[model samples]
Target: MDITSPSFKENATRAIGDKSLQKALGNVERGFIYKRAKAVAAVPAFETLRDAARDIKNHTLAHLDLYLEAYADKVAATGGHVHFAETAADARDIVLDICRRVEAKTVTKGKSMITEEIALNDHLEKNGITTVETDLGEYIIQLRGEHPSHIIAPAVHLNKEQIEADFRRVHDKLPPERNLDEPVALLGEARAVLRERFLAADVGITGANFLVAETGTSIIVTNEGNGDLTQILPRVHIVVASIEKVVPTLEDASAILRVLARSATGQEMSVYTTLSTGAKRSGDPDGPDEYHVVLLDNGRSAMLGTPFEDMLRCIRCGACMNHCPVYQVVGGHAYGWVYPGPMGSVLTPTLIGVDKAGHLPNASTFCGRCESVCPMRIPLPKMMRHWRENAFARHLTPPSERSGLGVWKFLARRPALYALATGIAVRAMALLKPKGGRFRTLPFASGWTRHRDLPAPEGRTFQAMWKDRKAGK
Candidate 1:
């Protein structure tokens, strides 16, 4: 809930030293990536679906105002209240107002990044309301008093052993001798604990994966059915989501849904894909008595028709983060914000201001993996480059980095000088090599050399080798 983004460098360094965190991060690659590849392979038209999804989002974002108006009308028509929040503070207040109206003592919630972005739980608790997380991964992090490290898998930074310990420590009423060695046992304990909270809570809250204009419906895709219970079992249901989540029609939403699960968790479909239009109707057997939707802009409106407009197409499936090498090493917590990874790198600066979150865009290796994996085909690396240039233009970049780039730019403009400078630098590096042809320490390169040796320049530069090959007469 705290904005530690300014201390991202320190957070990353600390995360590197945590063995448990490293071990937990390993599962991300070995599990999600591999499964997603297999899932994509099985679907022959997966690529086509991706392009279709991207187009749908592009079209929707271009006419976002129209769709949002239509969505609001549909919600009103269904007897649901639609609240527009221009900022995070506005969103928090709207939720707080609803809670106060109901005299809510406790609120049960499904996983929602929008809620995290607004710091909803902290604000509610500060106002004397108790918020209980119903999702298993969310419940674990809630018990540990930590923010989500991963978007979909909130507790991905934790392992089974850590979870066992958290449960034992938090669920004080449980028998001390109970076996929580297995994942099933751990899940069962959390389920039992959350079930009681769900039954007793006065209000329910959730995040929407998609909002349909034609139906005024909020959609949630989850492996666990906790979201359903979070919404249906309570007296009042509230949906907290960003403005970008709205889609024009049910057909467009269906197209996006086709790729959402495969891109996020490598499944054909999530176990639970629930859609709700509004509160219980006259004929409805069982449902909530009240329905409300909080739509937060939080700086998204300023991005339209700008260079960052493409970022508005994000579906929040989290494929970009899942495939990012930078995210893989440091983990999401290092980004030090509600959103982390490639999408976060671009979006956080937009929402929270570039000065505070500039390090996020700079953290990428720009390998293009995020773009390739994204179902929406968002140019994540290009957007990050835009941020880098913005930072440089504003003089927000450190003096050393700015000077280095300035020198490089000066040399790059001259072809002959650039080649000569690189040739001489390569020869000098070769001469400085000791014994194993590696440099353990180098001035201005301690950041890299501290962790791994820099391989010595073997001979001439690649340009020289290419020139020799081309001139082989």
Candidate 2:
């Protein structure tokens, strides 16, 4: 809910040292990477499919206004009210207004990063409505009073023991003799508790994977059936989604869905894929009485016709983070926002401003792992570099970093001075190298040396060695 970005150094240090979080993240990181690799390898046309996916997204973004208008008309024709939200505030207001009109008290929710981005729950609660997150992972994080750590797995930071502790704290009505050690038991208990809330909820809110323009259907894919329940059981169903989520037709949505589950969790398909066209139809056995779709722009429309347009192709599969070295070490919370990793680095800056999120782009090792794994094939590192350049252009980079770059630039312009400085610096480091060939402490680089010792720079500078070899030859 907080708009401020925390210090990267401080948050990253804590994230790296968190033992419980590391244990949890390790299992999740390894599992997803392996599964996705297996799925991709099994499919011979995966790369070609990615190319097609990229093209579809590019074309859609190029004509976003047209598709958006078409989608509005279609949804209106289907008896669904569609509201356009130009800002986060507008989106939240639209949902809250619907709840107020219906005099709703309790709201059941599916996992939606868009809702998290708009801070919908906090706003609704402030206005005296109780919102319950239905997905198991989301419910766990909600009980812990923390934002989601990972995009796909909100409770990825919590180990079983931590979850047990949280459940014991929240599940007060549990019997004294209940077993809280195993995951199944905890899950069953949560299911029982949430079932009651589901039946009692007056409204439901969810995020759509894609909105079909032809028939005005909101498509949601989930491993658990909670999303289906959230949309159907409540009297009112509200979908909060970004404008880029709309596709031209169900056929187009199907093409994207083919790659979505495989890249996300390596599944053939999620357990539940629900498509709601409108509110309950006449003579329908079960469905919401009212359906509303809030299409949020929230700075996304500005990305149109820009290099960042490719980023909107993201289906929120979260493959980039699972394979990232920095994300593996620090986890999602270190990014200090709702979205994390490569997509987060690009999207966060656009929505929140480069000045605040500038550190995220610099956080990368530029190893190219993210770009390689991204299903959308977004040029992630190049985009991050663009953000860094933008930050530099705006003078948003720290003064210390600017001064260091200035020194390097000054020396780099002169060959003689550069070679001399390199030779002296190499010899000085060689001499100051610790007993085992590593420095335990350094004056200007204490931040680097604090966590891990730096190995001594080998014998001579590259230029000096090259000159020596030339003279001898």
Which one is best on TM-score? 1
Weakest ten-residue segment in model 2 by summed lDDT:
1-10
The lDDT, on a scale of 0 to 1, for candidate 1 is: 0.92
- Angstrom error of the Cα, residue 62, model 1: value is 0.9
Residue-by-residue lDDT tens digits, candidate 1, 78-104: 999999999999999999999999999
Q: Residues 94-191, candidate 2, lDDT per residue (tens digit)?
A: 99999999999999999999999999999999999999999999999999889987889888888889998888888887876789888999999989
Off by over 4 Å in 2: 427-435, 458-460, 463-473
Model 2 residue 455 distance off true place after TM-score fit, in angstroms: 3.8
Candidate 1 Cα deviation (angstroms), residue 171: 1.5
TM-score for each of the candidates: 0.96, 0.94
Model-by-model lDDT, in order? Answer: 0.92, 0.90
